[model samples]
Target: MTGSGFRERYLDVLASIYLYNEHRGYTSLDRVLDAVRQRCPDDAEFQAEIAKHRADEEKHYRMFRRWFERQGRMPLQVDSGVGHIDRFIQWVFRCSIEELDTSEIVGSEDDFERLCRVIMLTEQRGYAQVEIILKNRLIMSDPVMKRIFQIVHKDEPDHFLPYQRWLERQGRATAKWNERAADWCIHKILMLAKLPALFLDAGRPRLQRWPDEDDAITAH
Candidate 1:
């Protein structure tokens, strides 16, 4: 692929980048579903929001699945650069939850805002990567790929908007001490948790970086 030239190979890198991101997203949605369903206030509005994200997740999963299916590979099993990174991200979320629990700093408006912030980060990260993926005409050249990214990208942005509103509300509200503490703990936990995955991601597409010095069957 590199023989095509550095500039030309930009498409290759861009595609690989998003493919990795997609893997993290589809996998993480299940966790998000669990968190939202189990914890979000049981109000009608909250339930509606959960349903909306659930539907969005299912649709997004199919979008990536369709594109990967066309590519003749299972995305999860394939080495999308972000897969390992995602593992670390999951770990970090776990850490955040643990921290929040121990901090005894939540159960109010601020807690909700913190939760929204965490979710918002995920959506933001996904959107940025998806934006690139959807823009890669060469990668999306396959009709299925183009359609998949389009369908998925359409509703993906919706995930972030509501959470953003939540944050705006937090800024205006004076949350209780518990809420403030919970938010602080969760925030730090999330930031700290993200490190490991990113650390491993430093070495990616090992073959791409090193080139032909690899065994095709094993690497591929």
Candidate 2:
């Protein structure tokens, strides 16, 4: 492929990976929501906010998948070995996704808020990343990619603000620590884990090809 063609395909692959991660994220967030319910079953507002968050995630996953379908292709299999939040949890808590769910990662209310901070910060970072893509004239030149990120950008604040509001209500002094933890997990460790995959995938042949052509109609 030509250099520009490779660049376009690379961006397409990134979009597919983003879609895959959104699916992964919502699944993980569902687990988090379950834990939240266990911790505060009676907090109607928290419950409602999380329900909306869950719905938005599911919607975003569908949006990306549909975008792939519109291109007459299936999404690339995401590199799940190292996702942002997953790696963060593994590094900080030393547990796999399955273990993170089964184990009581939060012993007290403070710990629960800490977990919330991690997710809130993740969404905040997600918004920024999407914003960067949207602002890039070259990337946004593609109407489909632009529209997808635009939708995602709109939903990010919903994911973030509710958590921030909840944290504000707590009147706790843990903000700085939580921010630091988020940076460590998302910016430092997870990025490190993803670096190899980025380098390895570069210039790969037909990186965005459909995995199974016959299943396109039923793929979701």
Candidate 3:
């Protein structure tokens, strides 16, 4: 049980992050694909890429959930917490989750471009973090966790590239929008979500125990 504490904490964070992403995978990414189909009805290439992206994200969501079940635990709740990208969208757009479902958050062609910027930056952040996790010997020593990150990291670039290509097609505007979205997301993730998790135990692991146990036990 030498590293059990850290391991449990890591799994808790992992499960919560994936659960959060999965919720958005269904809610946001699927919706984004619908919007892409509506707007670029004739661009078969773009539509195909987005369809792949949506499928990958949905697959990721299921994978994470299955990982949790294998560990005999449920994902920690993230609704009030560390889902930074989703929270940032809610804060900036001033939209409720219900409103987000049906509403065209990406109004107009310009707004669509800006939405791409946000998605690209978020995916970039996700890519970097997953790379770090994969490189961490402590986390990756566990075969289950290692395999999961490997699969997720493989998909990150695919998530990023479509938005990037679309922005490149739009020319100089990408620079302005990209910087703005990246900065905003980084700020919210660091200031609003991540830093607080470190200090406040938002995704901290609870001591494992059997039902009706008198005291908690080590994670095994």
Candidate 4:
């Protein structure tokens, strides 16, 4: 393949892996929503927000399915490997929310700040990694995949900010040092586990030529 063609093909593989992780959300987020709801069992607003996030995650999964189906089959695997990561992050979020719930009673803002720190680390901090992959055009080449990344990357920054504002408003953003080690250690491990999937199936040889739209119809 020509250099540009090789680049596009390699990127296409990376895009496939990214889409797999994104689509895996259907199951992963279901667990997260259930856990979050359990954490805030009596809060109707919390339940409502969890429902909304689940809806968004479903839409994202569907979008990925549409694009992915056009290229090939999916594994239908129950464990996308990122499930552990998602659950841990949700657990952390739940901890913060739970802490925020009690903050009004004792006027302690520490949990709220920790929550923002986790959010900033996971969301805004995530961009540092994604930007490296996305900017390397050779790592994700399909037009549809490119569009998806651009759309997602555009919204990434905005999602990471609210928790910080929430912390400042609640007067918590400092580190507690003594209690911070365990969560941070776990977060690091989950993140490291999640990052490798991006590099899989890179440049595997095609077993067959791209199918024509009419070919699919005729076969059907």
For TM-score, the strongest prediction is 2
Tens digits of lDDT, candidate 4, 107-200 = 3344434544554454544456567657766556567766766666765565445444544545765334532453466446645654444334
Tens-digit lDDT track of model 3 for 1-220? 3478766776667666665665565556767888888877887898888888878876777777677778878665455345555655565456644466333644577667766776777687779888888888877877877888899899889887888898888683554654666456655666566745743575445435322132124222
Best by lDDT: 2
Cα lDDT tens digits for candidate 2, 9-29 = 756666666776677687777
Off by over 4 Å in 2: 1-4, 102-107, 177-185, 188-220
| For model 1, the run of ten residues with the poorest summed lDDT | 206-215
The lDDT for every candidate, in the order shown, is 0.49, 0.70, 0.67, 0.48
**In candidate 2, what residue range of length 10 has the lowest lDDT sum?**
206-215
Give the C-alpha miss distance for residue 34 in model 3, angstroms.
1.3
lDDT string for model 1 (1-220, tens) is: 2444543343334344445544345444444455555555454565566557656665654555455445554322234223333333334344432233422223454444555565566565556656886776665665766776677678777777766665564464323355445444544443354333443343433223211123234357
Give the TM-scores of the predictions, in the order they appear: 0.53, 0.80, 0.78, 0.52
Q: Residue pairs in steric clash, candidate 1?
A: 105-178, 105-182, 106-178
Each prediction's total of clashing residue pairs, residues at least 3 apart in sequence or on different chains, is 3, 0, 0, 2
lDDT of 1: 0.49
Determine the C-alpha RMSD for candidate 3 after optimal superposition of all C-alphas.
Answer: 7.7
lDDT rank, highest first?
A: 2, 3, 1, 4
